[model samples]
Target: MRLVIAQCTVDYVGRLTAHLPSARRLLLVKADGSVSIHADDRAYKPLNWMSPPCWTTENTEGPTPVWVVENKAGEQLRITLEDVEHDSVHELGVDPGLVKDGVEAHLQVLLAEHVELLGVGYTLVRREYMTAIGPVDLLCRDEQGRSVAVEVKRRGEIDGVEQLTRYLDLLNRDSLIAPVSGIFAAQQIKPQARTLATDRGIRCVTLDYDQMRGLDSDEYRLF
Candidate 1:
């Protein structure tokens, strides 16, 4: 199945009923003879349309939300729950692990660039920091005597900010370093997470895959 964002428009009924800012129009074309329009980004509600036999809905319980349906000619259609609530790009069926890998790889490049851009001396303490809570992506120290912990996420996984915050708290309590700082790096951040980071004065950086892979090594003097 291939999911594409066709366009975005003001959904008056959705705006009035659900109050979402804009309704993103999505087109899902399957290798089979099934095609669908996902609206409102929610999966709990059954899909009811004017055309009978053209669509039928079925709900099922599992690790992820599952909606099974059949088309006019009895073609099977499966809509995972995450598809409606979260961006389909982040769905399990999608390349979520690949996205995470891409984000982490990009973060490594950004860390090197940040040190050069700010003209500050820094050292990477650990690339992947393992802890009781979980693995923190990057741990570094800056010239200004500050310990920095960075957590990175891809475009779809902006929820990493909270996880980074928790790691920051742990680092402050467990490490000898004073005035520990946190960095949240991602391809994109959710509005709520971005607002929270700004309010807390956390350093946030956004990096796309291309930016990560294209770091200029010769421009920076490495100590």
Candidate 2:
């Protein structure tokens, strides 16, 4: 990644803006060795750079230090208090697919363990299995000959309900499996969606981040 510098401005009242000029400039450098100056406030927050220590140190009547130098290999760039205002900007430009892949991986492990813990006689049929409907995350069969479709969403938003609903619809339409039941698992669930799901008799479960991360070794047996 190449280093470049760009300019930015701050309007929001926060730790980074308490000392610097409200309308100061910021320098932004792209990884591809390109530089652009942005006067817009929205463009700065996503940069993922920490606010310079000068703002905090100066506020306490400490020494007014010089600019901070961040060295990457042989390249060095000096970042001032004003430049650190946009540290989170880089995350905004990340690939959405990479985020999805990570969420899916975590969900796969959790779902497997959850099934075993329930002591339900179920068989893990497929993972990330492609069907006429789409790519179903996990497809399993309970001992009672009922097909269970599980979809995992990391963020646990209400949107996951709609997604699972679609999968259910596809399963019914395609006649993929008989007596199908769907489970939508996430870290959290929207209140309204939870009510709606309950009313509709939909099986929506909430699994926290820690629970997903703590699956036992036997959980990997499905893989």
The residue ranges of model 1 lying beyond 4 angstroms of the native Cα positions read 1-99, 102-106, 109-119, 156-158, 218-223
Tell me the TM-score of each prediction against the true structure: 0.47, 0.48
RMSDs, each prediction?
Answer: 14.4, 16.7
Model number with the top lDDT: 1
lDDT agreement of model 1 with the native: 0.54
RMSD of 1: 14.4
Residue 223 displacement in candidate 1 (angstroms): 24
Clashes of each: 1, 16
lDDT tens digits, residues 1-223, model 2?
2222323232223333323333445445443232323444763334333221112111323342223323232222233343333433352343223236676677666676456532368778777755543566788887786788877776655556655665665575456585567777666778877776666556776665564466464643221
For residues 164-191, what per-residue lDDT tens digits would candidate 1 score against the true structure?
Answer: 7656766766647646788777667778
Report lDDT per candidate. Answer: 0.54, 0.52
Name the TM-score of candidate 2: 0.48
